[model samples]
Target: MVASGDVGVAFAMVCGAGAASSLGASCVFAVKVASPRVLAIALGFAAGVMIYVVFAEILSQNAIDSFQDAGYSGNAAYRLATACFFGGMLATAALEALAPAEVVAVLQSDPHTRDLLRMSIVTGLAIALHNVPEGLATFVGALEDSEVGASIAVAIAIHNIPEGICVAMPIYYATGSKWKAFFWGSLTGLAEPLGGLLGYLVLSKEEPLSFGIVFSLVAGMMVFVSFKELLPSAFRFDAIDRVVSTSVIVGMAVMAASLLLFTL
Candidate 1:
């Protein structure tokens, strides 16, 4: 007999395959060179995607649902979700603090040099692991509501642009080839659909416990990305850093206020 979650899994796989194909094709198109300042701006764009998802989608969704189910007062769920958001942030901060500095440093470097190829491969592995939950989120969203899924698709696509940039930047800097940079950067995006497939397979059933756990895990994963990946990269440039930081706060505040408005 087919497992309960098989359909979801199948959906995820299909989505993953499609996303991978699309990203692969997109990467082949090379763009002209830009300075470090431009690259930093690209990183900031990535920052916008990450921050927007966390506050606008992830935390906002969690707070509303958890607030009602937990039987918290109007203010309590808002407080709880806000706390959870920060908790997610703190958890990622801890992971960043504990993670091997050398590894991230290598990833932050240019991708072209032959010496760093092995390191780049390792970075790919790390990113692949990271991409799984994002895939799942997109898959589940798509499955649940087409509109929700569409929103998520846009968010994911935007989030991915910087990811491509991230992957390409190092390699392009090292090799100075737009083709090579775009190719590698675009390849990283394939992981999203793969992640979506995995998530759908695992979380298709309507078990509260499973839902809660997946939600928590998703929250954790986003936190890790936001702090470990996005924020640090944002800090690499002074102007971008300020803009990204302001964006983060604005993102969080907007979500928080929205939740407050809804609860009342």
Candidate 2:
């Protein structure tokens, strides 16, 4: 059974995750326009942070912790972690394959007002689906260790900001209504909390949750997202190659420094 304190922490962390998307959406009203180059760079940065976290932190931690918990060491734990990681990749790949094709089409289409509303709705749904695993990852991290949870939350929030912009900008351009755009963007974020709730319900029932598998799975999903979604989107603008590359490097540095600070 989950303690009351753990429940509260999960709730708070999910709320924070939801708010990050809203905060990004609010930029629609605050700034008249955002440059594509800037957005692409930001997307690259988010991808970099996620990739580094998955390899340097999440997978390594899972291997170590799982071995300790299982009273095993060396190759056995490493193999288990590796298997779980690929399993996660496979699961996310399946989800991606099953995702609504309309959402992908809408995101790729030129920004026409006639289709913008439909696009916003479809995009929101797609984002909601993506956020579910992210929410679960954040909750699991926090449940295992508060500091780790906080770090994951921050990384996911940073990732969500670009998503918020993607959702809000087209809506605002199409309707000239800031509130509508923000509403849809925030609506997408609400899925995070719902996902957290689902995770809590499922995990609370387990006598001893298999955190190693969970962590590996989450890491794989994140890496898949970074590669399949973020990096491709970032590279869509060919002119900003230098900017995106620099941003990615900076993002990795920042996340690495944050991990170091946490350790210290």
Instruction: State every prediction's TM-score relative to the real structure.
Output: 0.60, 0.83
Model 1 stretches with alpha carbons more than 4 Å out:
1-31, 34-114, 144-152, 169-183, 239-242, 249-264
Residue 122 miss distance in model 1 (angstroms): 2.3
lDDT of 1 by residue, 104-201 (tens): 46755645567676555555455544555566666655554444444455445544554454455565556667677666666666777677766665
lDDT (10s digit) by residue, model 2, range 100-216: 655434546667758778777777778778788778777777776676677677767766776777688677777888998888877788878886787677567543326667777
Q: How many residue pairs collide in each prediction?
A: 9, 0
Could you tell me the C-alpha RMSD of candidate 1 in Å? 6.3
lDDT (CA) per prediction:
0.54, 0.74
Q: Report the C-alpha displacement of residue 6, candidate 2, in angstroms.
A: 4.7
Top candidate, metric TM-score: 2
- Candidate 2: deviation at residue 138, Å? 1.7
